[model samples]
Target: MPRFVFIGLLLLVSYSGMPQDKNVSQGRSTTSPHMAWEDLLQEHVQEDGRVDYKGFLRDKQRLDSYLETLALQPPKEQWSTQARMAYYINLYNAGTVALILENYPVNSIRDIDRPWVKKRIQVGAERLSLGDIEHKILRKMGDARIHFAINCASISCPKLPAYAFTESGIESQLNQAARGFINDPQRNTISPKQAEVSKIFKWFRSDFKAEGGSLVDYLNRFLDEPVSKGSQVKFLPYDWALNDILP
Candidate 1:
């Protein structure tokens, strides 16, 4: 072979031997990934995002299958930021629902014994709790909008969407989630002089402020009427009642 062609071939082989990104090594599985969970949410979750917990309990099998899939297929570092966020968001929501169903007939998610840190879930090779999914992983992913994405099945939590988030539309979904949560009057008491919002905005103020400078600056992006500078802001009390639908 010509010297030039031989060098080119050698370089190609050497480059191919280098390790790939963890998530990129094997293409992320997109195979009906969250359909089961999505189907359940679409069917049983109300337009306002209230869940029909009784109906969910009756259709527990689908949730079990979805959880199994999540446990088997863990997301790796190489996945797109959008995809990683979506997966964790879905995992958090689905896992939370399963947790609630396991201890059903309860009035609220806090009824369970140490529910957030129980380490009862089998996610890939490790056991994780809702706390791990939220604090350890998703929070470190660096999106304050996530505060609105992960629901804890509580009334004060951001309303869980009727549709599941997918890599394809995660951005828009997150944007909508933020807007919906921040603008909902029942949760946010907003006015020119003051803005009292969910405890979430208080707890994760840094996250929202990071994106738009300050809490007020962020709210103006979504609020129809902007909160003026020097406005007094209060954190509303969190309602821990189950976000379940009534018969």
Candidate 2:
């Protein structure tokens, strides 16, 4: 081989042998990556209680870029506990919205449930499907609050926030999410005499109670006019179909 070609081959071998920076090895850039998940959380909330989907879709590059910073290592000293939680939450939320758009022409997200809707999802050049992100990744790794955070594009489903999630702001974000969902009449609030609750409270009644509040206490925090104490509560039939924009 020519001398220059030989040198080039030697350099390639040397580089391959060197220890790779896991964050950079994947060819992801976290340089000046958005560190405050709160900024993303604030942007997520809109006046209408609906997330800013159009804005999020427009900045798809940022979401993809940020996710690349996620650690591929096991939950250990290499990864901050907070980072792991933020990563899982971000993936769940972002992947869900991506799934809806990938199949958006359909009237509802329910359309994606058919056996034929299978498709590959590319995040940071890694391919996984919506099902993989939700059931395989988020559900497997996250806590019960996730049921409230992961929006399925349904009106009855918890609304997707416009901003991204970060570890720093998770606690406040969760409280805000719980409050927001509880206040939305379509989701949970109703008159004192006839309260129709989200299946969320029923499904995860233990989650709220665990935090020192019964489902009633949780709902009361967000009620415009507090429901009378001791009022009977009823659960509304939750619509699991997709929350699509109507023409």
Candidate 3:
């Protein structure tokens, strides 16, 4: 065989034998590990999104183990958008629960001094507050649906999902969250002519309208009975009570 042909064959064999990056493919990273978080959610979060804090207290060690996994493996730039989105959403939620457990028997998350801005969550070498995860990272991702995914441990906040958000299912999961929150009568009383919606719409007005449309237009997408374009929208008072399952 010619020297150039032999060299080409050798190079191909060498390249094929090299270990590939398991986390990456086509410039996107694989999904983050979330089975532990999912298990915790299934065990403690109720169907209605209310939490069994006391149960969580009993399972604190499992929760901490999951959080430690996340803290050590901060998302990389190569991660798919969905992967990153799921990571932050789960991190924010798990971290919030950890925070609440740190101060169990509290009436509301707001009762904690500066609950959101406190930098207690450690991801890799960085320390981030819940506020950082929501505002600085998730919001910047430009997915309005996220507002319905991250729970604030409040009655008025969107329900905490019973399952962990996974990269493969993130899109559908977000759509379901938005639809559920928008249509749930406890959160929003909607009519063809008028609507009284959650304060979430008021607080994150820009996020809902991030895509080119009115807030009402956004609601129409999720409402079973679409509100009239000219319907009067009243923002309801937010309930800051903890979303705990009382015995």
Q: How well does each candidate superpose onto the true structure, as a TM-score?
A: 0.85, 0.62, 0.87
Candidate 2 lDDT, 1-247, residue by residue in tens: 7999999999876543312223431222132123333245455445554555565567666655544443232233455545556566666565566565556554566767741135444544466665665666665554555666767667788877654444455565666676677777677757866677888678667665665656667667656767776677777887866554333
Q: Against the unseen true structure, what C-alpha lDDT does each candidate score?
A: 0.82, 0.58, 0.88
Task: Please give the lDDT score for candidate 1.
Answer: 0.82
User: Number of clashes in every candidate structure?
Assistant: 0, 5, 0
State the lDDT of candidate 1 residue by residue for 1-247, as single tens digits.
9999999999876433322222321222234367677789888899877898899999999999988977877776666777778788998899899999999888999989998989978877999988998999888888888888899999889898886777767777788888888889988999988999998887878877777677888888888788998788899899999999976
Q: Indicate which candidate wins on TM-score.
A: 3
Off by over 4 Å in 1: 1-32
Report the lDDT tens digits of candidate 3 across residue range 1-247: 9999999999876543312223534323243367678788889988988999999999999999989978877777767888789889999999999999999999999999889998999988989999999999999999999999999999999999988777777787899999999999999999999999999999899998888799999999988889999889999999999999977
User: Model 2: C-alpha RMSD to truth?
Assistant: 8.0
Number of the top-ranking candidate, with lDDT as the measure: 3
- Clash pairs, model 1 backbone: none
Against the correct fold, how does model 1 do in TM-score? 0.85
